[model samples]
Target: MSILTQSAAFIARSCARLLAQDCLLCAADSRSSLLCTACADDLPRLPADYCPRCALPTPAGEVCGRCLRQAPHYDAA
Candidate 1:
């Protein structure tokens, strides 16, 4: 590797070590991202069935009733 690349990597590692990145929610060690793997996995995820127009959770994979009656301003969600 080039000298500049090596130097930059060293500096980054030093900074990371000094800063000691940790998960905001769990206070676990996080390498680069804000949240750790465990905390990120525990977060609530959106369901597969959702209204495309309004992006609301729905039983069927279709536009919500409200959106159907009154079309949304934008074409896409």
Candidate 2:
């Protein structure tokens, strides 16, 4: 990453350490981030068998039917 971006992230982390922040979802103490660990982990993740092109859930983990019929502009989702 760029130096400025890195610096900004460092400063943000430092500030989070100094200030007690509440989780945006649960209103619990999150400390270093906007979401508590439990809430963060509870968030939905992409399915393991998702299509690589469109990120739609696929039974065989291959490209979805939509992408196969008409390809997406970009590559992997």
Candidate 3:
């Protein structure tokens, strides 16, 4: 990208960072990130036992039944 474009993008991002102090979800005051700490903590997270390839939640570390029966499109995730 051109230097002018890069500078404009940087300035825009800086302005957005300055202006985006409220959480997007609850409109609560956020320190740095888009979401407040409470909202961030409340977000749904994938289980630690999820399949590495398809990211499907598994009881154990082994591949999920579906993936074991039929491999996913991607070789590695």
Candidate 4:
């Protein structure tokens, strides 16, 4: 590896160690990330029956009505 890459990585690691971040939800120290491990784990997960295109909840996991009428440019959310 290059000397510059190694030096940059070392500096980044030092900065990460020195800096402590707070979680958005609980305001606890998360250290480099916005959310702490516990708060991140407690967050809600998307349901299985969501639209593939727009990520909206669907009854049968099919495309949502809105997407059907006016399709989005992206294939998936």
Candidate 5:
């Protein structure tokens, strides 16, 4: 029947979608194909406490001591 044929086509398309997706940032192959899990995990997340100038990780709520005493020579201080 036409209804059964339509159902079959729909099922086929759905199956195709289920097979894979692409990585979001790089447009690379992906198991999920939408910001693949590894790429998502690799994304840089800001730590709670980080270097004021460089944004590198720092001990939570603590400055690196040297940075607190005086601005670096190049800091335009």
Candidate 6:
């Protein structure tokens, strides 16, 4: 690998080792994965069933009456 890339990798590794914490989801460089345990378990994950337009939770995979009428403009690609 290139010298600059190697140096950057080394620096990242050193930083992670200096700040290892159980609650903190970190690796030898950056976040271990998408969501840490504390965040994953504590934070609410958006359910599969949600309003497509409003991006709000829904039970039957259909937009709520309010959204259907007013329409939420937050749906995205």
**TM-scores of the models, in the order given:** 0.72, 0.61, 0.61, 0.59, 0.34, 0.48
Candidate topping lDDT: 4
lDDT of 2 at 59: 100
Number of backbone clashes in candidate 4? 0
- Model 4 per-residue lDDT tens digits across residues 5-24: 99999999898878768899
Cα lDDT tens digits, model 6, 1-77, are 99999999998888777754444444323344455655667776678988767767889768867787876666631
Question: Which residue pairs in candidate 3 collide?
Answer: none
Highest-TM-score candidate:
1
RMSD list, candidates in order: 2.8, 6.8, 6.2, 4.3, 8.5, 5.3
Better by lDDT, candidate 4 or 3: 4
Cα miss at 32, model 2 (Å)?
Answer: 1.8
Name the regions of candidate 2 deviating beyond 4 angstroms: 1-17
What's the lDDT for all of these models? Answer: 0.90, 0.92, 0.86, 0.94, 0.70, 0.67
Task: Give the better candidate number (3 or 4) by TM-score.
Answer: 3
4 or 6, greater by lDDT: 4
Candidate 5 worst ten-residue window by lDDT:
68-77
Residues 1-77, candidate 5: write the lDDT tens digits.
69999999998788767765667787777754478677889988888887765555678745556677765756421
Number of clashing pairs per prediction, in order: 0, 0, 0, 0, 3, 0
Give the per-residue lDDT digits (tens) of candidate 2, residues 1-77. 99999999999888877888999999999886799999999999998899999899999899889999999999988
lDDT of 1 at 55: 84
Worst 10 residues of 6 by lDDT: 21-30
Q: Which ranges in model 4 have alpha carbons more than 4 Å from their true place?
A: 51-56, 63-77
